[model samples]
Target chain A: MQKIINGKAYVLGDNIDTDQIIPAEHLVYSLSDPQESKKYGQFALSGVPRERAGLPDGGVPFITDGNYESEYSIIIGGSNFGCGSSREHAPFALQKAGVKVVVAESYARIFYRNAVDGGFIVPLETTEILKTALKTGDAIEINLNTLKLTNQSDGQTYTLVHPGDVLPIIEAGGLFQYARKAGMIEG
Target chain B: MPMTITEKILAKASGRDAVKPGENIWLNVDTLMTHDVCGPPTIQIWKDEFGGQAKIWDKQKLVIFPDHYIFTNDPHANRNVSILRQFAQEHQLPNYYDVGGERYKGVCHIALAEEGFNRPGTVLIGTDSHTCTAGAFGLFATGVGNTDAAFILGTGKIWEKVPESMKFIFEGEKPEYLTAKDFILQILGDITTDGATYRAMEFDGRAVYDLNIDERMTLTNMAVEAGGMNGIIAADARTEAYINERSSQPYTVFKSDADAGYHSVYEYKASELEPVVAQPHSPDNRAVVRKVQGRKITKAYIGSCTGGKMADFVAAARILKDREVKVPTFVVPASTAVARQLKEDKVNGKTIHQILSDAGCVIAPSSCAACLGGPADTIGRSVDKDVVISTTNRNFPGRMGSKQAEVYLASPLTVAASAVNGVITDPRDAMG
Candidate 1:
């Protein structure tokens, strides 16, 4: 029952810290409700008028606010995603917003583990795929079973391969799920 | 394989043979703590992943506090606290600290050590990067992602890559006013931000020995900013004495062998360091404080695992005790215990509270607060004239308030002095 959606796509580059993920002001709420803090992305743009021109209405579903179009079922960001605090909310917020998987060029060591634990599949794919296959508001389909991503806009498809080491965690539905399947707990 | 301090500690915690660099080993955590700012998201993931089971590990092993976002300025913060409160109740966590009095714990690093959660020869992990501060007490500590923390909570174990260690040999007379903070700042500037990525830094030299336990803690607390996985000082007599002064437990001594191998070696003199500041956007872009002084400041914040130490306060107090804070100042004590000590010191006026209040300083509950633009900041939108001098690590734009607002990083003493002058001024000049 992994929820799949052709949610709005918002693209961000790389090296986003937890502070940017959830500004210190919005951190006062529970992590389960990240949609409530979604508006803070405006803080990232400094002062120019927030250009949500290509963003989906009601804000982008899969990506943060103030982001534009993207075609990949995942985001192909630069080196180091989730580099700051150990705040798990960074990933949870993404998952809750319908990010089926985040395909980063590289990820901070800590953030990589956090994504899988939340059951948000994050596959490490080539950043080159981000060049043409993805554009803003293009609907993309994600298949958890096959780990495939398809962009309906141009009938493009890309095979999402989990990083060699991270495959096990994603297969188990996350760390806690994996722990249960390992019979480390009493039923 | 040669073992680094992180590997050595990981090996000890795992009850295994030495762990080599790049090799993954599961380690037993001596202490695991999370603050309100970082802990809530972790707890949510934990519950979503684990479902209705009392934690897989002992409750006594976990510590929870709402230190970062306690002022309840926005609805999101209020909801966040509510979630933490419920989690604390369901988990029945033994060390839950709220936002006031005995219930009030300041920053998680100081709270853990002062409350005896950081024991010698132990490994502690927190969701906050400053967790490395525990290394001052001879513990292996680092910040982990919420996912990692949740896994540890459920299994009482974590995975780590034994990092290589770099040795710094310092030999020289320490200059007056220059402190361990200045020494570490120089090291950061030399190495750059990515210099120590995934590396263990072992601080040595006669200069290190000259620093007391509190000052040493300041050095290690910000090691994360240097991309260092851990910062450790070989447990010497000073370390032993520090432990003995506070605890009844006996801890065996640990040190590098006479010829223990290191990945790299560095040498620096203590007397050579001047007041250094890491400009905004990066912690490695360090410049001499004198280079940035007189920069206008709109707000001044002094608190965090690094700046709220007793010595940091003493230094700030010595300069600002009877003075007025130039910009609106916020002083968040690192721990309730530190606050109590500040009270006992009779810091200038009738009490530390009255004295700080009279000096235009706003005393916030012990938490990260305005240091991270948490509810503690009431400043309006960022303006070109507004600059903030903060003791906390990291000055990324929008980190304190508006992205347009400027932030200058410095030591607590420097921050206090700057606040009194309404501009960035060297603490040495204020001392003079």
Candidate 2:
């Protein structure tokens, strides 16, 4: 919560569902095993069509072959991002791929909840459509305290929708940690 | 203040006399459903969070089904199923339905009804988006991810924001060719995928109540396609009858007041809406069958939680009877019971199964085969830019296997009609 978040941005179109995030076929890998779970990172965002894989410039890979980590650590998406399936693996894959935050116009309810509760990525809302203004590999930085995002590529700063009700949970690092700190769960 | 059925149900669960939209409350869940793909991950998180003190809040209220990735040969998929089996055995859960066993059920949503767990005026959370399918029975049901499900598994409680309800009224005598699938597709086309995000969709009107339980499920199952939190219907006599025959648990029945508030209301004449399909890559990309006819397809699929029920097959049989399909058509039942019914029931003296088989449709084992593009070897999965018209709920890129393939989401009647001609066809052409 004290750290400033910044990374290269990977952009995508609207309705990028869980299937496009992790795909059902690769859901078999173990999330608990370190070696096996890294496969989730390797396959992250592999299901997106080649034409929309990386926005502004299409077909740029999220993770190059033989690598489990992604170069871009922030994703810019249009409205209804993560619009299908309720798989927490979708968010987990993003986290595993080194993504620290996602700026999107809107989100499907379950995906938004999963991202916050699992402490995978910070899903910030943008009053402006970030996907169209940003290109893949643009450097971005997030202000942890004010939840502000600024694109270093264009020097354009965007205001995020106040994290409001779930801000405490995100700041505490996730629901489990939040509950522990709030004494909602017994240690 | 007046409230809709969804508001009433949430109010009762949250221990309030009345509640309004946008209020946050913790609901005491009545049941938690999980399937093979999500169950193992949920249990792992529960164990990790609680350590040795890990425990299920209510074993009887937790239902596990090894449905997804079942009937697959992939090692990783098999390992996932084993994880669920071990967890169920360790927990001694009464509701776990094992794969390759007598108690096995194909899909968790439909099986929830068959096992008498979908009681009215209850809150049910699950790890699959289609859990909203049970809202057809007049309950509060919605999908959650593994983390929220794990939290519920330990505490049997989860906080939810009350959602403003959208009302859809389908009027007029229900048309023979126009089923609930047609109306839902029409709604999707009009509203787009995110129209009802974080909200409730309540189905009403004469045509809605006129639908049987199976067909009613079809209408509610796709509510998630619109990003709805849940889809609900007020419990009428038909709903009560369906519940009474399956469950004997004492449950409260709640309804919306005549003055209940709604975010928006849409009225449609059921007779006027024609069969339509959500053409490739998006569920809301709808096109009328008449307008899209003669678009060639490589495959026709009839199955999934949304489209693989007995009523769906019955509709398909109505078109495929005494006819042959020109393209490769695959039939997958949503549940094992539905599969058994296809053999036991008859359409014009020939079994529905027989009619489908004679019509050159390949029938796969009951489970979520090829619907979500499961294992690499899943039956009937698309390949090589294959154009498929399927009855499943989703058609997102790579959802049914090949990234290069195109999928069109349609009702069973339209799928069957298209199957006969190897192209998208107006269902009316196949009707008597």
Candidate 3:
């Protein structure tokens, strides 16, 4: 299935930390209901209200029926996505908030690996075409099977292929899902 | 053939004749770690996902430290400790340290290093990103997620891909005033923060070899700060001498082949470098210490996995001996072991803790404390617009509470000197 993300982009300039993705303070809360975590993004910027209920223009997008609105699906960030700390909650919060894929110039190794293992995060290469084509509220379609990322605004397309067993894992809904299908887990 | 530190650790873990860059293999982790916050969730995941059993690869191979919120005055933190205690008992994990009444050890990285968990030619993994600190002892260490930590706890095995190696070559004489912290900060400034993502940084050259084990460990400890999975300094005679002083454990020597190829290489001359500090908001925001001089501080702290080594404490104590802490200073040794060493050296009351305590310093147990806000050490409203010059890793906003407050990263000596002056002063001034 190919889904296009359309929303005002709350683009990060570059080099976001796990603490910024989700503060250590939020980890104190119960992990059961993710909607509770919708307030998570508000804490990213300091001095701001703890509950910035009004969604940022490119806040987060949801392809699923029951997800946050203005909620962005695809995150177009600068180099080194997830640059600080090894908190899995960083990726978990992003996934729970309906971030389908992250398009960045590069990714921190631990973050890249953790995102892959979790399964929901699909990190695409940040090429010039994709970068130039992307803006706040511009739509993007990312096809998992073909690794095709299209910027709907300029009709620009990019194919990302890297040497790894990661594609199948993302397609299978992350490592656990892939492991389950591979008979690593008991039915 | 001289094997790189990475190859040596891999060989030991995999029982291979030799290993090189760019090979994926499962290696036995010499030491595995989890903190309070990450540990609780990983334990929950282990029970829910992997079932309750000590059916891991080895019983003696795991180590757990409750350093994150050891001084937590929060009710939720207290509850988490109880949950951790239950998990500890069920798993029979022998190494557990508590806080308050208990003899609290410092942060995990410092405790492990002091207790000899980190050694050359071994691979270590911790749930904390700063686990990369073990790289200082020539061990190949990296941080893992709670889920992966759970799998390791359940199975005692870790999956890893051989990474491309980048060599940081340092040459030249380090001035007496210059320390490893300055060297590393300079390197971070040179390479920027995201410089070595996904690569293993192998420290090389004459300047690196000159560093003592503690100093070298400080260099490797913050490798994650550069976004690298791990950092290694090839074990040499200096390393061998240091390891021999600490433990009788047998260590297989590991050094990169003279002709070993690195994917990328960088060089720095230590003599040309001066004290560098990471300004508030990011570790990569580098500036000369001279630029940030005279910034008044409300708190000045010196301790963390990265900067709380024995050497750092001793250095801080020396600068703070006759001086006093004007702000509400906190001088925590990294671990109980470091505290013991300070005591044995007779530098405790005469120089460090006592002097600072007499000067209104709030002495606390060795833990992540204010670095990660362990309740007892978090910031209060009174601290607004105040500055902090701390030796702990990361100077991100609200790290020490108030968003309006400023936090500066500097060496322990600089931090201690600033405490004495009640402002951000250079250690050079205090030395005189």
Candidate 4:
């Protein structure tokens, strides 16, 4: 795992639910089939515009034209990110779509746990000021060791509250890896 | 130090005398539940990560229920169940509930209670977010993802952080029109959807304790809607009686300390609360029923872990005894036990199922039939541009089917009234 992550940031508003991240209709793909799992990346953010209320023209699809994988690596979001559904596919889709870190004002409890246990993405809890300070396509640098995020575009720095106890699991690449290291599993 | 009920349960699970909020502990889980929707994937992960030689940590503690998307004829959904059936047989699990079998249960949450897995003073985890519903039994229960569930499958333990507690006190006399659904919607409206993020919602006060076991489950079931880590109520005589009727398992009951620390406390007058509806797109978009009345609806649904209990049906049946539903209405029981109760229990010399059927309501199979918007064949699904009023949680676009269809969330009484009127109408006006 890299201590410093630099990527283009994508911005979204409040209450991004699991359904918006990946709709239930697309969840039929078997996790056992690697060929079908690739389709999940394309469906990431497919239902966002429809579920979110009061957005212009049904809101802009965050992953435009299914090119988010190469275009963006970080998502900056408002409060209640991943607010509904306990589907791990939500974070898995984001991870498959090339999202490495999610900086949100807050997260729904289940989604936060899924993201950490799957080691799909780094869920960073930051202040609301970051929601306003960062914009789409902004160059952002995050230091996992220092819990500091720097907006290279605006020369602003924000401190994120470190999520305790789970840091070791994230550092070990996921819960399974951490379990193996802790002698909790036969691996 | 005095500890909240959640803290005490977590401390005990982690083998400590006491623990505080924000501290991490590894919990030895008592039960792990998974349904058809998430079970196949969890099993796949379990095999992929743990290899073929690994066995489940405990066969009795791991329960599998194939409820959602099972009634439909979709082959993919059927395949998911087949995978679960094979896994259960191979693992020799004792708690697998297959569809159309003698041991089958409808919804996992309600089945957990009826089967006595919701014992107090324990830690339970499920694959569904509504797993918090089990917390009503005076335990610490919450939802975990498929990966975490897989970890538990192999190790029988999970890592968790102790969450801060928020106390909500509902006082005053209960009104005739108000149900537990109404009380929770009021709290959601006041707190917003994410108001209690990363915290435990400890429900107490006169009105909550006065509620029956099923109603208490309703309150805890929707706790996840408010971003609560878990919603809990202390187990009392009501809990004991409810459990004793289902199972005679010995259990330990825990209570919160009077001086336990809470992040915040909210007090509400129960009598003052009105029948409310969560408008389109979000549960937090709540308004009083009178304000949104007369909005035409194409369908009305009363089912799911939240509102498909026997009490909810009784409330709806009271309003629709002789009245015919103007729009399509679906009556689904939460579990097979509830469905059986509906068939056996009489209201006004007729079974509640008969009343609902005579009222032109489609009595669908007891499962999460249309709540999660199952296959195209699922009954009561909202089609293109249809406006629906439902008693299920979540009104997100396409939640019940088509994105163009609008959904208004309400209580069973409100839904019945609206169904009879072909529009959103307050139950009081309909009763009058």
lDDT of each: 0.68, 0.92, 0.70, 0.88
DockQ of each candidate relative to the true complex? 0.37, 0.89, 0.43, 0.65
Winner on DockQ (2 vs 3): 2
Please give, for residues B137-232, the per-residue lDDT of candidate 2 as tens digits.
899999999999999999999989999999999998887997788889999999999999999999999999999988888888999999999999
- For candidate 1, lDDT tens digit of each residue in A49-166? 1232222232334334465212334444444555655656566555544456665555654566667665654645554445334665666676656656677777777676545655
- How far residue A70's Cα lies from its native spot in candidate 1, in Å, is 8.2
Going through the candidates in order, state the TM-score of chain A alone for each one.
0.67, 0.97, 0.72, 0.90
True-structure lDDT of candidate 3: 0.70
Q: Write the per-residue lDDT of candidate 3 for residues A1-187, one digit (tens) a residue.
A: 2344443333554566676576665555444345554553433332222222112333332222343333566676667778777877777777666667777777887788778766546766654434334664557776655667666777877765552656666667655566558775543
Off by over 4 Å in 1: A1-14, A33-73, A100-106, A121-164, A181-187, B73-93, B248-252, B346-359, B376-385
lDDT of 3 by residue, B237-317 (tens): 777776777777766667777776677888888888777788887788888878888878888877778777778877777
Q: Alpha-carbon error at B374 in model 1, in Å?
A: 1.5
Chain A TM-score, prediction 4: 0.90
Residue A7 of model 3, lDDT score: 36
Local accuracy of candidate 4 as per-residue lDDT tens digits, B139-196 = 9889989999999998899988889999999998778788899988988999999988
Residue A137 lDDT, candidate 2, scale 0-100? 90
What lDDT, from 0 to 1, does candidate 1 have? Answer: 0.68
